[model samples]
Target: MTLKEIVDKLGATVGLGADKLDREEEYCFASDLMSDVLTLKDTPVLVTGLCNVQTIRTCDMANLEVVIFVRGKRPTEDMVELADENDMILICTPYSMFKTCGILYGAGMKPLY
Candidate 1:
């Protein structure tokens, strides 16, 4: 689903990249470790409990287009600025990681194979 659609369905609030909210994301990966995400090849939406600037750097290195911070953790100002610099869409959801992943997966989003 498109980022905009996901936001609408989950009632998530956009933290960054508001203008690019309509961008389509075909896949998702849930993790807090940047190293693991760096190994991924397919472009996907990232779901993490992490809310730091390093997450933005990892997203840049991994070529991810979107990040949804689960459990309502707010991204720091530095992270938001870095995400804006990297052109990544950042969002926050009230759902826990497991529930959020399930919801997205049920909605047809998958991890990169």
Candidate 2:
């Protein structure tokens, strides 16, 4: 699914990188554990609730492009700045992590495992 589609479906707000919404992703990884996230190989959309600087840093290390913050978690300025520097897309969704995962999966987004 396109990042735009995910945003529309989840009624999420774009915190940054709106221009990059056209990016396509078939897989998604939902986790708050940064260590677990680092294990991902495919460049899937990261669905995480851990809205911290480390999240952005981990994405940078993993070279992931898009991140959806679930349960209405918003990014801090530092986090946004770091993500902006990395040219990554930041999305905020009001739904819980489980609902976010289910919605994306129901919409044909594959899971990492």
Among the numbered candidates, top TM-score falls to 2
Candidate 1 lDDT, tens digit per residue, 1-113? 78888998677999988888767778888999888889887878889998888888988987886999999999988888888888888899998999888889899997776
Residue 15 error for model 2, in Å?
0.5
What is every candidate's alpha-carbon RMSD to the true fold? 1.1, 0.8
Q: Where does candidate 1 stray beyond 4 Å?
A: none
TM-score of every candidate relative to the true structure? 0.94, 0.96
Worst 10 residues of 2 by lDDT: 36-45
lDDT of 2 by residue, 1-113 (tens): 79899999999999999888888889889899999888888788899999999999999999998999999999999999999999999999999999999999999999777
Model 2 residue 79 CA deviation (Å) reads 0.6
**Where is the poorest 10-residue window by lDDT in model 1?**
18-27
**Clashes within 3 Å, all models in order:** 0, 0
